[model samples]
Target: MTVHFHEASQSVTTADAAYAGLDERHAVQSGPGTFKVYRALGKRIFDIVCVLMALPAVLPVVLIMMILVATDGGNPFYSQMRVGRHGKSYRMWKLRSMVQDADAKLKDYLESNPEAKREWDHSQKLKRDPRITRVGRFLRKCSLDELPQLWNVLRGDMSLVGPRPMMIEQRDLYPGRDYYALRPGITGLWQVSSRNESSFADRARYDALYNRELSFFTDLRLIVATVGVVCRATGH
Candidate 1:
């Protein structure tokens, strides 16, 4: 039984034979690929350092947004426990996108709004959620709502780039996927490459691909691309 995983990247075919495309499913399966040395440590160390350094820059944005949420809304920040490396669950922070009771209201909205339900069914996200605050709409469009996750990155809960961590419900939806094999990332391959339009299955494929093809330079490329992504307001 040969399972396969492929993702977007500068492909590094290794020297080992007999195990082409060896993935989370087959560690024993060897493949001829450039196994970048100390890639994980390098990636994590850089994540901590860069994110910590970025705190000062991010704080102002946080302060401004907190006021926006507080004056008109309530709670400037919200945290949801997302599944991380090896099935570890940790609180992933974000600037509040929807009303405080958004989670509780989700069920009712999903039942009533079939169009919203379809989008969520396909992408695990509601495209035009009415529950989202006015400030949140701009925040989502500008990708500003995610600025708070720098805290998560600093706290060692996430990476600047990696497989996008899934909410427990989202992870449960993809029960067949290997949730425990890799760490949850702040921005995954699917996010940088194509996020809003991509289907969940397609996103899953890219996630697996990124895991097999992970590297420092690749991560660097993702960081650079992220700026473009933000400027273009690519994330929904």
Candidate 2:
């Protein structure tokens, strides 16, 4: 399957020519193609417009997060590089939920506990991580930590819905080259469907499936389901 990265939206605007499909090394000429075109020219236009439309509702939440972080004595926004379509890297931004030196603490924790290192080998999260601050834990559980990602969507680095983007290290940890075909999304099938409970292999399967069948309606379904999951606090 050819993994394609799109402007994390419904816009046709581009810094690069719309990428044609992959080179022949990964071509599949004889199969019934199930992939729908969710990440496409017009889809991005939809995304940009959606973000603008949603700003009225989204602003209050963003302001709330900013207030908490600012009062809590930490940076309000966090940015990290993540792999996007075709393995290209982009800065994925989010609201900060950890202490300022969360990354440094992760390095220390990994070195101190062999068991944690074992989990980190395949899955990047610790089961009971100590680095997440109080507000961070609440934000993550409530899905509020991701509010800043809307800006990422507006910037075209990611989409509002699709496969979830992984940190740079996580991108390298994934096992397959074909997985890069889809752009990393803020909320995707894996996220609303299983999220924190899912294993790496399960996540890879869901993302691949979405890539094989990308479409506007399909994405809309995912987005609606994502809202349900978040509102119900059913998935992390």
Candidate 3:
């Protein structure tokens, strides 16, 4: 799939109009024709098999991170409501990568920092976020914080490759229809590509492109690319 990168100034309305001609029915199905067995069944099977094989290596790291994160006297795991296929919501889990009162800190910090607030509004992330702890920074860089999402993949609330899960509150901010038609992914086009560099709105374009070009080989390629991203520690 050729992912188009738009200027960061692009508005939600503009992004939506860009894909206004996309067929919603076709977006839900993998590629063109009906009876695409992979989208219906094989994709889920792939998620399960990959997760099962990965758990052997992933579980130990998760366990270790849990203890390390909890050493600060807070819950080691964090979960938040995320929009899933068909606009359904589910609790997406992750290893805690922030302080116990991250929300409160963020609210107060943003109010005092106009520049930071602008960044958050545009990308929904903070490069120099004060909420991240010392160990948390390392985990975020290595992307170990996202390993817990392997459970979400097994639960069928997510895919190994698809659009990144949008926050429940971001439902209004998102302008593309493709994300609602498919399960969210732990790593996808945006995540493996622009990631932290792009505005949150750019996700719509990547999600739509991914859906329009959905295929077994596409998922496989994205999964392999994810491994390289993780090895390079490109997160955060």
| Candidate with the greatest lDDT versus the true structure | 3
Q: Which candidate is the best by TM-score?
A: 3
Candidate 2 off by > 4 Å = 1-38, 234-236
List, residue by residue over 83-116, the lDDT tens digit for candidate 3: 9999999999998989999999999999999999
Cα lDDT of all candidates, in order? 0.67, 0.67, 0.78
lDDT of 2: 0.67
Note the residue pairs that clash in candidate 3: none
**Model 2, TM vs. native:** 0.79
In the range 25-97, model 2's lDDT, one tens digit per residue, is: 1235322232223355756877889889999998999898888877678688888998887888999888888
- TM-scores for all predictions: 0.80, 0.79, 0.85
Q: Using TM-score as the measure, what is the rank order of every candidate, best first? A: 3, 1, 2
Superposed by TM-score, candidate 3 places the C-alpha of residue 231 at a distance from the truth, in angstroms, of: 1.1
